[model samples]
Target: MIVELKNEQFYLCRHLLNRQAHLEPISVINQTNPGRVFVDDNTNPTSGMVWLGNNDGFIFFGNPHNEKFNQYIDPFIDQFLVEEAKKVDLDYMEAIGNSKDWNTTLEKVFKKRNHGNWNQRVYTLKNYEYLDKTEPNIELEYKIQKLDNRILTSVDLTNLDTLKENILESWSTIDDFCSKGIGFCIIVDNEIASYCYSNFVAGSVHCIAIETMEKYQGNKLAQKVAHTFVKECFIHKKLPYWDCMEDNDPSVAVAERLGFKSYFRYIGFDFSF
Candidate 1:
């Protein structure tokens, strides 16, 4: 019998999911602090698990597959976040995927609901090294340069609103990011030129997401901030994971520049109920 989990069981559940995270880190975001956790075996919540992070749902292969999951779980997930989930926010209920069973089940369910597909690609850092010393081939024009490492509860991007709508909107709130995630920003004249932070973190792995203002795109601010973020990841003994669309040249370029290697490719579907 599947049981809904409580805070007391978080440790055991996190342990199970963390082991699986080593293989599919992207699939197991925020498992350590999920909003809800369900497991077939209470003794080992990780053995057969479905974790509902703030917005994403995760499936793990532990116990034998059961048809009851399809029967009862869909409604539980469809109504998981209700109206807020239907909105296309960064932390919105976007996709559900993990092991083989997870992918197949999610595909079938969304198809039955007449939803479309959302394709995605995943990569991992390869022999990773910081870009702090490897400066980009660009002349520095800004007068005030600072690699502010403090996790700001709120970032000052007043001079760079374009980056806010185009990039930061998908990153939830500054307060949440500051408290739960770690980041570095290249502040130029009190404006955020480039920034890098953890979009998803679980266990020892952090998913890195970086954005540079349009005017500062070619100035190497991204490299500097990413270098700091990656260095911190190592300092904390955590691994870093990178994922982006296959056709996004800029992201692919940065990932490669940071020494990230293409490890796995997966699909994501941002469907509505």
Candidate 2:
């Protein structure tokens, strides 16, 4: 059965770590140190899987596909979180996800915190099939090669002195998550022009922020980098997930051109912030 740790519990911690080891590594999840919440049929209190990390809040990571754990264990884990929230006098707790099963569970437990309706979020991407037919002209080729060269030469941020101030200032901890996957940059005549990266969550890969220098804005390097990144994700057997503010037209266009289909949309509730 599922168990919630009242305090530090070593065995439950081990089980959670073991479960993470078997799953496709998610960098965002890895960066957080949120402790464990348990699951398993073993009568021993320490046995079974535990969900680890805190995104906006706690994350549940146990195998939903396991028959015994899925049926007997997961519900209790859900109940445990809700009960714990009440016990701690938490005004609100929320879970964010694109999964129907997760939404169903959250619907039953979390009081629909997105107001009257769940947030409408979309995921879209273009694959290699869409990208292959597009040929870059001489100008486009020059820009793409410039970007490729910049990324290859300055794999780390330190060597990119000219771009360092702006990049480091704007970089997100989430960027570290993107680094765990594919990252690329565009350079123009030895100058860093633009760059993009992907952050993988389970099999879903989301493209992180792409930025172009003011001088490079009209060159379409952002589009090229994005297309290349999506191609890489597909080659790696990962689905590239593109999420942007609902009003972000440029991002939406890039994702559409790259062959990403809009799947679902979500709204965020930031109780913590």
Candidate 3:
């Protein structure tokens, strides 16, 4: 039978994650990020799954032939997962299989209910010097600001609400993000034009999420803000990670131009509620 593992016990699955130990799963296992884990055997797990705390996705790892794990998948998807997602006000669920065997198993189980299949690219920064530092040459009234309690709590700050929501997407709470996260933003006309922040973190590895206001897109503001965020990561001896859908040209371009090398590719699936 499949059994849920306590947060402290989440580390048991580390061996299964192997080379695909991205922040999402690592954060959960480290208990730095909220999430749930289940395994086919409590004492000696051979297969398992992680339900991301943010309800964003699931990670299927280990032996795909674990009968108990295989049997639990359908109900977990159709019943438990669906209910939990709705509680979070989400309309669908997403997942990734860690290995080719697991990938094929996921396809076989979720194919009919699949909403979409995405090819995701993961990047690693071997050298910090490759980050583009060329600021927008145009004259613009803007200032770079580090994210802090004041920035997170300011009620009247323009676009700050959107930033808070984005942070909450992957973080359990604003306070949690403030304490463990690092970020930088570009303010234009007293409004946040572009920002980059840690989305998921495990140990010294940080995965970043960045966004630029539509009106400010062409100003190279994203590059400017991201450059600072990355530099700060290096200053602290942290490893910055970048992951995005393969078809996300803009995101791919940003990482590539910043000198992040493609690390790995994985298949992800979206399932309907």
Candidate 4:
């Protein structure tokens, strides 16, 4: 039997999710707002069936001890989610985890429904790029700026009406992180042309996210802005963490130029919800 988890079952959910987190730290997707968590065994969550991850994707995990848990892994994944996805018109969703059995069962789920592979890698860099100057040394045609304390912590993204609404969603997730988070960007006509910021963080591991307006690409805007963000990280005693798909040449090159090194490789799936 399946049960949708709520606050009453938070402890059990956290315990099982953390069991998965041990294998994938960044995979510890939901922390602030708990996403939908479903479990077959509320009493022994980690010992049986469960699923987790953030809104972008999910990480499904299964415990070995329960026979009922393993028996229904495929149906729990395929039939239940397929029907739910159809109900919500869930366009895209990807699920991954540390369990081979889960992956094996996931294959059957994919065959029954529809899903595809989303491959990616995790990267990190510890050697901080220290500089004598607090400000970035790089130059740009657009005004290069560091996030001010006020806007850094919180900003009315609605004020940025010119930017694509989807791109500005970072404010919702990273606002709180700004107190400790730091970032740099190039602005053109009061619009962010290219920028880099610490998107999500776990302790000293600051995950970096950067994007340049299509028109602004190829100007080395990403590199300069990211380098500036890295300098900011050092000033604040933070370690920059970088991750990208192994197939992402530009991302890999930028990280390499910024002195990021390969940390580990893990399975990543890409599919529609």
* Strongest candidate by lDDT: 3
lDDT of 1 by residue, 1-273 (tens): 456666566455554443442333323334323345566556654444454443444444443245655454556655554544546353433554554456676666556665555656666653345444564544454432322224242365465555333323334454544545666667666677777767666656677767887887877677667767777778777777887777788888777787776667666656555
Poorest stretch of ten by lDDT in candidate 2: 19-28
lDDT of 2 at 125: 50
Per-candidate TM equals 0.69, 0.50, 0.91, 0.72
Candidate 3: misplaced stretches above 4 Å?
132-138
Candidate 1, superposed: residue stretches over 4 Å from native: 1-3, 14-34, 40-64, 78-93, 126-134, 137-181, 234-237
Better of 1 and 3 by TM-score: 3
Residue-level lDDT of model 2, residues 46-77, one tens digit each, is 22332333222333343334455445433553
Question: Each prediction's Cα lDDT score?
Answer: 0.56, 0.48, 0.81, 0.58
For model 3, residues 98-143, the per-residue Cα lDDT tens digits are: 6767778887777567467889999878544565555344346878
Model 4, span 1-273: residue lDDT tens? 666666455456544443323222232334332245666766666533223232445566545344565557556656677676666456566666545455565565556555567556666656544332333344545777776554433344333443323223333444444455567767776567877876555556577778888876877788878877887777677777776777899998888777676665555555654
With a 3 Å backbone cut-off (N, CA, C), the pairs that clash in candidate 1 are 125-260
Candidate 1 matches the true fold with a TM-score of: 0.69
For model 2 the TM-score comes to 0.50
Q: lDDT for model 4, on a 0 to 1 scale?
A: 0.58
lDDT of 2: 0.48
